[model samples]
Target chain A: MVAVYRISAIAVMVEVAIQSMSVVFGIAGQGKWIQEGGVLDKAVIEAREFVFPEVIGYLIHGLNGTILIPLTALILLVSSFFTKVPGAVKWASLVLLAVAVQITLGMSASGLPVLGALHGLNALLLLGAAFYAARLVRRSRTADQGDRLASRA
Target chain B: MGMGYAEHGGHGGQVAGGRSVTSLVADPRRPADVSVTLAAGKERFRLPSGRAFDGFTLNGGSPGPVIRATLGQLVEVRLVNGSVPDGITLHWHGVDVPNAADGVAGVTQDAVRIGEEHVYRFIADQAGTFWYHSHQMSHEQVRGGLLGALVVTPPEQPAETVDVVALVHLYDGVRTVNGNEGDVRVTVPPGKRARVRIVNTDNGPMSAWVGGASYRLVAVDGTDLNRPDPVRDTGVLVTAGGRADVEVTMPEDGSPVRVHLGGTTAVVLGSKSYDAPVVRPPATTLDLLSYGMRASLGFDPNRPDRRFDYDIGRRPGFLRGRPGLWWTVNGSIFPDVPMFVVNEGDVVRMRISNHSGDVHPMHLHGHHAVVLSRNGIPAAGSPWWVDSLNVADGESYEIAFVADNPGIWMDHCHNLPHAAEGLVAHLMYEGVTTPFMIGGTEGNEPE
Candidate 1:
C-alpha cells in the first residue's frame, strides 16, 4: 500500500508540472499568433501558410485533454479500488468534469481573448486538483500500519 | 501631345509625369466648362527613367494634379474615352453629386463607349478634399494615372501665410522615388507654421510620419476640428481614402523637416537650409476623444431631428454568392443607391451595421462625428472620437453628430481598394440649394 501511495504521489506531481508547462507554452504561442495577425487574419490571406493548425490538432488528439489525461485518470481510479482509498473516485470524477467545462468554454468563445485566458486558468486548476487527489491517496495508504512496516522492511 | 505607341506586353504603355505633357490649367474662380478626352490609346510613357520604372505611373508622373474648386460653384466635365477595346467611366469619388453624375458604370449609367463623350455637371456645395478616377474597371484605371485631387475650399477660410496640400500617393513594391527601392523624400521649410492637409490616395494602407516635427491633428475627413492630438509614433497610418489635416508650428530659428511615407522619406527645410533637418514629434498627451461633445462640457445634448439605422453590407450577387467577400451599405453600391437625407441643423444618429466577414473602417467625408455607442453599448470609456470606425463582423455602432454643414457628403469605407469593391454612399442635407446646377449633363452626345 505504501509503495502504491508513493507511485500515485509522484505521478500527480509529474502531471501537474506538465500541465503548468503547457499553459506557459500555450500563452507564448498565442502571442506569436497575434503578432502574425491572429488566426483568422492569417487564414483569410493564406489558408495553408501557417503551422498552428497542426499544433492545435496535436493538442486536441494527443495531449492531456484527450488521450493522456483520461488514461492517467483511469489508471489512478483502478489503483484506488485495489488500495481501498476513499475519495479517489470522487476526485477523479471532479477532474474529468473540470476538463469538460474547460473544453466547452474554449469552444464557445474560441475567437475571444477572455476565453483563452479562462481555458488556461481552468487547466491549471484541474492539474492542482489531480495532484491533491494523488497526495490524499498516498497519505491514506501510508496511514496503514502494515503498509508502513512493509515499506520500512 | 502626340500619342506614343510602344509595343509593350500589356494593353497600354506608361505616360511620363502622370499628366498629359500638354498643360491645361483651369481657373477655380471662374466657372469653367472643361472637356476631358479619356482614350485607351498606346502612349510612350517613361517610368522614373533613371530608376528603371522606379515611378511606375500611368500618364507618366507621380501625383497627377490638384483640381481646385470653390464652394457653391458649378462645374462641368466632358469625359471622352480613348482607351482600346474597353469602355470607361470616371467616378468622382467622395463628391456628393446626383446619381447620374456619380459616374459609376453599369449601375447608374452605361459605360462610356470608346470615342464617346459623357458630360458631368455638379455644384460644389461641400468643402473638402475629394478625388476622381475611372469607375468602369478600377483596378487598372486607378493603378494607371487616371486619379487627381479635388479640393473644394470654403468661401471664407482663416487667412494664413502657408496653406499646403500634400497628397500622399503610395505604391507597392512596383514603384519607388529618387531611384531608391523604398524612399520618397519630401521637404518642409524651417521655423514656419503650416497647415498641411494629408490625403492618402493609395490602393493599399500606409503610415505617414514627419521625421523632425510634431504635428497636431486638426481635422479628419475634412471635418470635426478639436483640440490637437499629437502622436510621437514613427508615422500615422492613413487608410485608403482617409484624410488628416494637421497644424504644425515649425521649429525655432531654422530647423529642417522631412515628411516620410511608406518607407520613403522626403526632406523639406527652412528657407535657408539646402538640406532640411528631420523633425521629430515631442512627447505629448494624446487626446483623441476631446472633440465634439458640448454636452460633456456642461452643454445640453443637441439631439438630431431624425435617426436612421443603415444596414451596411454586401449583397449576395456582388461576389457571386461567395460568402465573406466584398463590402456594401444597405445591400447596394455607391452610385446605384440614393443618399441618406437629413434636415439642416438636425442632429443625426446613424446606426451603421456591419454583416460582412471582414472588418471595415467606415469614414464620413466632410464631417466628424462622436461615436456614441459600439455594439449597442455606450463607448464611454474607450476613445469615443473618430471619423473612421472599424466595424467588425456582425457588429454595429451608432454615431451622432449635427448635420449643420449643408452639402452632399460621402459616407464610405476608408479602405481604398474596398471602396473600389463597392462600399460607398452619400449623406445629403435637405433644404440646401446652390446658385449653379450640379450633376452630369443631360442629352450631351459623345464625340
Candidate 2:
C-alpha cells in the first residue's frame, strides 16, 4: 500500500517540525516570565524558581496541537484509504485540513495577537503541505504505478 | 601571587580572602598616611557645560583626581591601568575598603589589566564623603567616564570656608557638574563656608539646590550628619551612587550661590552674575526620612541576628541566555540570586521591597546601611547612614547593617542598568571565597 503511504507521510512531516518548535520556544519562554514579573513595586523578593524549559515548551506546544496533530492526521487517513493513490484522497484531505487549521491557530493565539502572527504564518503553511504530502508517497510508488499503467497503454 | 596585589591587613584583619570578610571600623594604620597616584586614562572630556565626550579617565579627570585624606590617614591609591577598555578597578564607592582592598573586578582584583598596576592600601578610616568608580564593567566603565572625588579630612585640615567637589556625572547623554556641562564658577568669598561635595555619578537620583543660599546637610554616605539642620525650602536628593555634604553660606550680598547640579549644571557660588535657577526637580524631596536629630545607633537595630527579605520584582526570565524584562533578586533570576548569608558580627536586617515600577539605587558594596524604616514609618532622622539607597517605586526600606564589612559583598543596583537587569544580590561572609569569576574567560562584567 505504497509502503503504508510512506509511513503516514513520515508522521505528517514530524508533526510539522514539532509544532513549529513549540511556538518559537513559547515566544522565548513566555517572553522571559513576562519580563521577570514586570515589576509592580516592593522591589526584588525572589524565590519563584520553577521554570523547566518554559514548562516543557508549553507542554510540547500543547501536545503538538492537541496530541501530535491528531495522531498524524489519523495515520494519514488510514494510509490514504489503503493507497488507491491518484491524489490519495485529495492529498490525504489536505493533510487533515492543515492539521485542523493548526489546532485552531494554536487556540486562537491567546486572544489574537494577530492570531499570534497568524500562528507563525501557519507554520510555513504546515511545513509546505507537509513537504508536499511526503512527496506524494514517492509518487505513489509501485514503480510509479507501473509507470502509470504504461502511460494509459 | 603577583597578578599584582598588596593587601596587608588590620581594618578587621582577613586581608586575603581564603575565608575572610573585612570589618575595619578604623584605628589600625601602621605607617602610611597619604600617598596618592591614580592614572587610568583614555579621555576627551571637557564637560562643565561646554560639551564633549568619549571618556574613561582619572588623572586626566572625568573625575579621577581628588583623593585627599586625613581623618585616620593611611590611604595609598596607586592604580595605573593607562588605556581603559576592558580593564580597570577602583570601586571605593562608600569606602570600607578591605576584603582585599575591595576594588572588585572579577571579585577583588584581576582587572587592573590593560597596562596593569594596582596597590589601593585603604584607611582614610571613615571620614566624610567618598567616591571612586570603575568596578570593571560598571555599566560601561561608569557611564564611559570612570569616576573620582573621595575626601576624608577632619584630622584638623580645617582652614575651612570652601571645599567643593560636586562630581555628579552623566556623560554621553550630557548632564555634568565636575566635568562641567554648564556654569561652573565656585569662587566663594562673600560670607565663606561652601563645602558642596555632591557626587551622584548618574544612573538616576540627582537633585542638589542652594540657589540664593541657606544649607548645612553636612555629610552622608561618608557619614557625619549628627547635628546638621538648617535648610531653606528643600532640594537635596542625591541617591544613585549617593553622597551629599552641602554646607552653603556664600552670599554676603555677593549673591550668586547657585549650586544646582541637575540641569544647567551650576556651582556659581559668589556671583558669576546670578540667574541660573530653572532645574525643576520638585515633586517633594528632602525627606531624609525625618531630616536629622535622632542619634546613637551604636548597635541594636531592634536585635537583628540576620533577616533579609529584599523583594524587588519584574519578570519574563532567563538572565543567562538573554531574555528580557528581568530584575528579580528575591523571587530569583541572575545566576539564581539570593546568597545573603552573613556572620562576621552579623546584625543584618534587610527588608528592602520595591515592587519594581522604578527607582532603585540600593547599592550596598562594603556596608554603611542604617535607614531603619520607611513605609512602616520609624526613622525620625539622624541615623540614616546609607551607602547608596533610594528604593522608590512602591517603596519599603527598614535597613540596618553591622555584619561589619566582610567579603562576598555587592547587594546590587545603583541603577547600573538595574544591575544589568537582574537586580543582583549577595552578602556572603561565612568563610568567604571568591577566587573571582563572573563572566569568565575573565572579563568580569561587574555591572
Per-candidate TM-scores read: 0.53, 0.29
DockQ value of candidate 1? 0.02
- Write one digit per residue (lDDT tens) for candidate 1, span A13-85: 5764666666556556667765763422211221112234334533533365444655565566556556666
> Which tens-of-lDDT digit does each residue in B290-408 have in candidate 1?
33233351212345565666667654444333433355556654445546666556667788888765556676644557777767666543234456665656888888877655554
What TM-score does chain A of each model score against the native chain A? 0.62, 0.36
Model 1 C-alpha lDDT versus the unseen true structure: 0.53
Candidate 2 Cα RMSD after full superposition onto the native fold (Å): 22.2
In candidate 2 chain B, what residue range of length 10 has the lowest lDDT sum? B1-10
For B176-203, candidate 2 gives per-residue lDDT tens digits of 6777666777677777787888888777
Task: Give interface RMSD, per candidate.
Answer: 9.3, 14.9
The ten-residue window of minimal lDDT in model 1 chain B covers B1-10
